[model samples]
Target chain A: MVTLEILAISMPISVLLGIALGTARVYGNVIIRGIASAIVITFRGFPVLVTLLLIFFGLSDFGIYVPPFWTAVIGFILCSGSYQSEYVRGAIRSIDIGQSLAARSIGMTKLQEVLYIILPQAVRRAFLGITNELIYLVQYSSLAFVVGVPEMFAVTKTFNSLYFRPVETFTTLAVVYLVMISVLVVFFRGIERRLAIPGIELTTK
Target chain B: MNSNIPVLKVENLKKSYSGRIILDGVNLEVDKGETKVILGPSGVGKSTLLRCINMLTLPDSGKIWLEGVELTNPNTDINKMRQKIGFVFQDFNLFHHLTVLKNVTIGLTKVKKIPEEEAIKIAASALEKVHIPNTLWNKYPAQISGGEKQRVAIARALAMKPSIMLYDEPTSALDPQLVGEVLQVIKELSTAGMTSLIVTHELHFALEVANELLFIYNGKIVEQGPPEEVFANPKHDMVKKYIASIYSRKG
Candidate 1:
């Protein structure tokens, strides 16, 4: 339960971080983009288990005793944020250069242009990628068990150890996770279909 | 009165991209309310010239003055100068996310700070001028035909009510069947005495509508005069070769 709450908090926090980093990767200057890319690649290249251990255990060695739950959440967010940045960057680039030119020609400030014109279009483009990332994140929640936080997956392991009925306990946990992701997939697909630009084909010929 | 102080002037315009000269030492002038057509062969920098005039493409070196405002000067206010000259792109760069009405209204509302009600009213009239029905105002760019989108782009420019309109091959991207409607809309604007600088390949249309014609080649004005005089009499060998090629194609 504690692990689940951490995962839930991590999900939204990381999504927001992903948006920020992704937007920077797409629109920032050379130096800012370089830093953002380094952060994204560094987090994504390493294993989540290693990352969690480093944050929860390694930090304790340095005299910092932060809560294990927040540590897992931080590690998960770093992992998710990197992947999400790629999605946001790809979505923003998919938009036509003409759109930005048209906005600028009309005297819109650069920030105003992005806020009113580019972001709306980029958001619509990024929706599917974000949904896919959500599915991935739900699966990633299982990694929280390595940190000794008793979420759904960790709870099942405890149940298996106590009852010695590992098969039935693991099966139930797997089914619960599968059902949750399936529902999320269906819900996001509906939103994607409804919110997509009308009559505008997403695929380029 | 004082020759009406040419609404636009370009002197010694020079531009190059990666060692290739695009607009090399070009010069021209357009008086207030006169329609000027720039005729050029493909890749001769006609569009680049227009792009530079609007500051859409910065020139390496040049002087561009619009409505007594020095556009090419380092001290000039780009946004302010841009507001006074509405540009119509060849690709009809309408905001794909916006409806025809919203595309037309955005600049007016956002840049000019015009009241929403008044901007909508102006947008409606501008669309009516382009012959796009108010019923189609809510339709997105993807829902409209290329001709309709071009007209919407024109309407978007018109809504700004700038001192001049710059058209870079306004009808070039249209299908053969759809070309006439956009040309017809531009024809109507000519009679309104609006200052217009058009870069186009429609020779007959340029002859019929423009007060003066400029023939550009290799980023310089090779020949220019009243359309009738330039077309009827050959002054330069390059101009003669160009005209002969077009005439032979028709023959």
Candidate 2:
């Protein structure tokens, strides 16, 4: 339940942030592009655990306090969003330049070109990378336990300590993670197929 | 909407890329309902001229008027101006992700702010004008043939109901067999009294559909007149040579 809650909070926020940052990096003017690039590089480079620690613990030192659960959510969003931006950027670049040009020649403004013509195609191209990121986010939810959020791993640890059954408990935990990841992989595969372009296939090897 | 004003006019248009001149003081005009074909050898700024008319490639120095609006003025709203002049590309640049119907309707609904039902009505008529069957309207660009893709592109532009249509080598990328269908559509548009400026290498199609033919060479309009007159007289040595090469190839 905690794992699902963390994912529910983090995934949508991260995806939206990633799209905004990615588009700014690709199409924004000098100042915006530079800022987006800096954000993406900084968050991608910093460790997620350290980032969570910084938000939850280090910020209190500077006279700001955020609750532990929200801190973990913020950390996951920042970290995942930066990585997601790179995938989105790659997908946007992979689209042919002619698509935007065609849209413009038909009298669509630049914003309309990106919104109607470019982003739909870019999202499809980014699908595989995005699904991979989602899986990573699911696993990374376990990191919330370190910040005192009683998520999946945290609950399982408490149960294991009380029961004193290391082998059985750990095996069950591994199986649960495997089941969760498998469901995610299968669900996204269906989406990828449904949204697949009729004549073109995008594959990541 | 003034009948006296030419649909499109270009004067002293000049453009260059990296110290290399492309269009050098080029000038032309297309009256309402006139079809003008621009014929030139490859790399002679034919496509660049079309791009400049639409301001897709801004001219280094030029004046362009579409329906008497000074498009060259910096204050002109380019996006709105583009709605008046529809442009078709050499590569049939259809939005690959969109259905044929959506490709045509997008501009009408989004840019023109027409209601979706009205846009669909206009789009359907435009597609029908290009002879695209109703069955193909739901298909993506990649699902269609090269010729059908070009027709879809034409339909896309036509649905905007522009005063003038600019075709930049509309058939250049097609297979030899596919070229005829695309050219046939353009020929029909010309006969239907649509004002058009076409850049093409197809000498036969130029002679057939063009009310006036402009032969560009070395970045200038070297010869231009009614197609029949230019073809028969061949005033310039360069034009004479060009006609000879095309005829020899035909033989």
Candidate 3:
């Protein structure tokens, strides 16, 4: 359940940060956009392993003694958020400019236009991409074992070595990951349906 | 509601895109309870003019006043002022995600801070004024016909209770049969004394609705007078040509 706990916490943080990052890149002034762009490029350019290792060990280099579990969570959020922002940025661009103009015509402020009009439409369009990210998140959480956070894979590895039950222990780990991924997919499917606009084509993949 | 002050006034409006002028020295006045139609060929800056009056497109060098407030002034609280000016676009720009009723009430709730129940009451009356029955109020824009969509757009604007309505080719996007439905609603609203300025190519509809017809050519009001006078004695060659073409098409 530690795996689930990490994912539950990291997922919401990453998604919120992803939205803020994408909006900054799209709507911010030159300096803010530059900062958001630089973060996306840096996090995305390095491997997820590199980020995890850096957070797990490099904090010691700075004399920041964060717990290993929190270090893994921080790493997951930063890396996953960078990837999610790319999808969000693409979705925001796909929405019609007419939506913004219509909102503005009725005297909605610029921020209100983004929050009430543009983001709702963009988030719906970004759902499929976000679901794909959720699937990756299930798998990515397993990487926490490398930081000695004792997630599912780490526990399975220890059990396999102690009991020498490679078949049972590894297979159970595989099934758990499978169940988590399937549940994540179904949950996102429900969200996609609830958020679907009247005219949009709802694909059932 | 003073007699001397026009509901809307534009002075020496000019706009250019990349040095190619669209509206050059355009000027006009719309009095309270008057419907003035600007008849022009497409690309003569009619849409730009309407957008400018709404400040959606800022004029390059000019001034606009709505009910004695100079809109061009930098200190004008644009969002606050915009609530008092209604604008309808050619392609009915309804909030697609919202139902017809919510589309009309959204501005009331979000912008004007009206309570939901009260906003719905205002929306219902506005929708009724535009002839949108309650049955269709819950439907999204995609579920409705084009004429209904345009009417909802009008209702969305009208619910704000603006001093003047600016319609930018309100019926140009409709099918021929559907065009009459939307125009009929506008006619009813105008005849009932809604101050509106319409930019459209529908000469027949213009004659039916407008008290004054302003013929625009190359971004200038080439001829202006009562519809009957402009049709009977068009002063400029451009106006004469435009009226003749419409009459020829009818035959």
Candidate 4:
């Protein structure tokens, strides 16, 4: 129930941050893209354990004492945003150049062209990546225990400590994650198949 | 043809790619309501020349005046100038995701800032002019035939009410049977006195429709006159050789 509560709070924030940053990376100019690149490298290059330890312990030295749940949410949102940015960039770039040209030929301003023509196609292309990231979010929700937030994995650990049966506790947790992820995968695949364009590629991968 | 200050004029046009010239110092003029066809072999810069008319290619050096407005000036509003000049590409270049009606209405609403209902009304008339059925308006480009796609491309351009239409090998991508259908649409436009510059390989269509024909070869206008004089009299050796090559291929 703690993990479920954490996911309910953090998942939407993670997705929203991912989309906002990912969109900027794709449409932003050279300097903006460079900055976004640096942010992504810093977040993704460090191990999640190192990031959590730094956020929880190192930040206290700077007189920045963050609550455990908020700290976990911030860390996960940054990590998820970095991981998903590349997928969005690839999807936005993969759209046919002709679409933009067609929009321009019709007298669309650069802003209008991006908002009306380019973004719609790019969003469709990015849906599969977004779905994959959702699965990663579900799995990564387990990592919130490192910050002492007591998510699903934390619940299993407590159960194991009480019962002295680690195998049974972890086995049940594994089955739960599996069922949840499979349900999400099937649901997304159906949506993708229905919205798929005839000529354009369905996935960048 | 009405010669009212030459609705479209090209002077000393030149285009080059990596030090190789494609349109080398070419000059031409089109009076209002005249259909001028630029005939040439592939790679002779026919498409590039037409592209220059709307600043799409940005000619290396040249001056194009449309309706007395100088296009070569850097200060010129290229978007406004392009809005007045319509272009049909060899590949159709229709938006694959957009419906035929949307494709036509896009320019009207976006460029002209016309109201949506008014734009739709204009697009409908343009589509009707191209003889595309109103039933096909909602279809995507992938669902349409090459001929129908080209017609939509034309309608998209015509929605702007352009003063001159530039066609770059409009029927080249169509099947042999479908080529006639697109050419017929163009022929109707020509008869309606729509000013046009067409770069085409269809010698017979050029002969039948063009008031003036230019035979371009080796990046130069090797022959220019009425189609009958250039195709029949054969003053230039290069022109004769090209006609013979085309005939041999047909045979």
Write model 4 residue lDDT over A1-205, tens digit each, in one string: 7766666776677666666677778777998878888878888898876777789888999999977787787787778778877777787788777676656655566677777677666767777787787788889878878889878888889989999898888999999999988987898888887776655456564
Off by over 4 Å in 1: A1-4, A59-65, A203-205, B1-3
* Best-to-worst TM-score order: 2, 3, 1, 4
Q: After superposing candidate 4, which stretches have Cα over 4 Å from the reference?
A: A1-27, A52-67, A198-205, B1-3
Greater lDDT among 2 and 3 belongs to 2
TM-score of each: 0.93, 0.97, 0.97, 0.87
lDDT leaderboard ranking:
2, 3, 1, 4
DockQ of candidate 2 against the true complex: 0.81
Q: Write the per-residue lDDT of candidate 1 for residues B1-251, one digit (tens) a residue.
A: 35567899999999999999988899999998799999878999999999899888999998999877789888987886787787888899888888889999999998889999999999999999999998898899999999999999989988888878999999888898998888888888977888899999888789888999999999899899899999999688878887888888878
lDDT of 3 at B219: 80
Better of 2 and 4 by DockQ: 2
**Reference-based lDDT, residue A20, model 3:** 87
Per-residue lDDT for B35 in model 2? Answer: 96
TM-score top scorer = 2
TM-score of 2: 0.97
Q: Native-contact fraction for each model?
A: 0.50, 0.74, 0.57, 0.28
TM-score of chain A of 1: 0.91
Question: What value of lDDT does candidate 1 attain over all alpha carbons?
Answer: 0.86
Candidate 2 lDDT, B1-251, residue by residue in tens? 67898999999999999999999999999999999999878999999999999988899998999999999999999999999888999898898888999999999999999999999999999999999999999998889999999999999999999899999999989999999999999999989999999999899999999999999988999999999999989898888998999999999
What's the C-alpha lDDT at position A139 in model 3? 93
